[model samples]
Target: MLKRFFPDLYVDSIYHIPYETLKKNQIKGLVFDIDNTLVPFDVATGDQRLVTHFKELTRLGFQICLVSNNSEERVTIFNQDLQVEAIHKAQKPLRRSFKKAMKLLKTNPKTTAIIGDQVFTDVWGGNRIGMTTVLVRPVVDRDEWITKIKRGLEKKILKVYLKNSNNQ
Candidate 1:
């Protein structure tokens, strides 16, 4: 059903998420998708702005984790400096990785949120686990071919979702 792809919140990007609002709601942990969520896939590392933003989040006492379907090599190299708990090749839209992410954060479903650019994987998985899901627009136009294909389908879904939301 379309509900699986419906995010609890949709924003222009991760930067647009209201951290204070989430904190007020008692969200204690955040699970993020690496590529195109925090940074574009082509960027070798998080930029200065992203680094500062993440530092701020940590300073505010939020546990963070990177749950990416990307290979260990890519995730490892990208996270060397970030140093957050991370799981690569997460096989998302499945419950196992979501549970693993919660354990890594020492948090439970009620206090955790998933932030990513993809609906099928991030939104669906988070929604299935009763976690709040935040969908952000992709950072770049270029991506792996597989993801590019998903983008096409996601466009259609988003259109319907937006239309329905407006009707409501």
Candidate 2:
């Protein structure tokens, strides 16, 4: 159903997330999608800004994990400097990797949230597991071909979701 794709929160980008509010709500762990969620597809590493942001989150006592469908090489290269728990080739929208992430964070669904750009993969997967899902706008317009196809469908779903949300 369309409700499955509807994120608990939708914002412009990761930078727009209400981290303090999440903290206040007792969200102790965060699972993030890397490419196009935290950085553009072409970006190989987290920028200094992102690094600092991660540090801030850690200082606030939040456990973090990066989950990506991309190859291990890609995820490894990206996480080399950041050093947070990471899962590559995640095949998301499937519950397995998400469970694994929660295990690594030592957090349960009630205190964990997933942040990503894709509604089908990130939002739906997290929602299925009872984790708060935060959908952020893609970091860039360009996307891998398969994701490009999904994006078109996501737009339609978002239209209905937005209408329903506004009416509420």
Candidate 3:
């Protein structure tokens, strides 16, 4: 149950994630959430650091795709600038978008991982599809109202989970 709620993996920051770790995990592809994960929600494009990381991942032979709940306009701006395939209005935690992303990457779920800041959408959707899920702290905490509420609940659950883990 705890495993179901928590992400399969956690990283301090997406930039710090090692390519070797993904290789060891047998992850040949990755689906990423854009806003607040790769960059702040308010920011329109990725920073130089993120662009460099993306290049490194591509060089490492890992297929990358962006799956975001944001509008097409927003995603288009990202895709055009980042030069990567992306699906907007993903409706994550539903599996449809993730499936579509996998189709685009031509990678099997067994060799794919989903990385994002939010547990409810990114982690849940990845876990539902039997893919490894990675959770990173949000690049920025300010978010939409619904997301803020969800984050609050997620925080509570995470606190409880940590307390229990410490006790055991």
Which candidate gets the maximum lDDT versus the true structure? 2
Candidate No. with top TM-score: 2
- Candidate 1 deviation (Cα RMSD): 1.1
lDDT, candidates in the order shown: 0.91, 0.94, 0.86
Model 2 TM-score is 0.98
For candidate 2, lDDT tens digit of each residue in 1-168? Answer: 689999999999888999999999989999999989999988899899999999999999999999999999999999987899999999999999999999999999999999999988999999999999999999999999999999988999999999999999
Clash pairs (backbone) in predicted model 3: none
Clashing pairs for model 1 are: none
TM-score of 1: 0.96
What is the C-alpha lDDT profile of model 1 across 1-168, one tens digit per residue?
787898988899989999888999899999999989989987878988888888999999899999999899989988888899999999998999999999999999999999999988999899999999999999998888888889888999898888888898
Q: How far off is residue 94 in model 1, in Å?
A: 1.0
- Better candidate by TM-score, 1 or 3: 1
TM-score of 3: 0.93
Better of 2 and 3 by lDDT: 2
List the candidates ranked by TM-score, beginning with the highest.
2, 1, 3
lDDT string for model 3 (1-168, tens) is 756667766677897676698889789998999989988887888877778888989999999999999999999987775787799999999989999999999988899989999888998889899888888889887997889889987887678766776696
Candidate achieving higher lDDT, 1 or 2: 2
| Candidate 3 stretches greater than 4 Å from native | 163-168
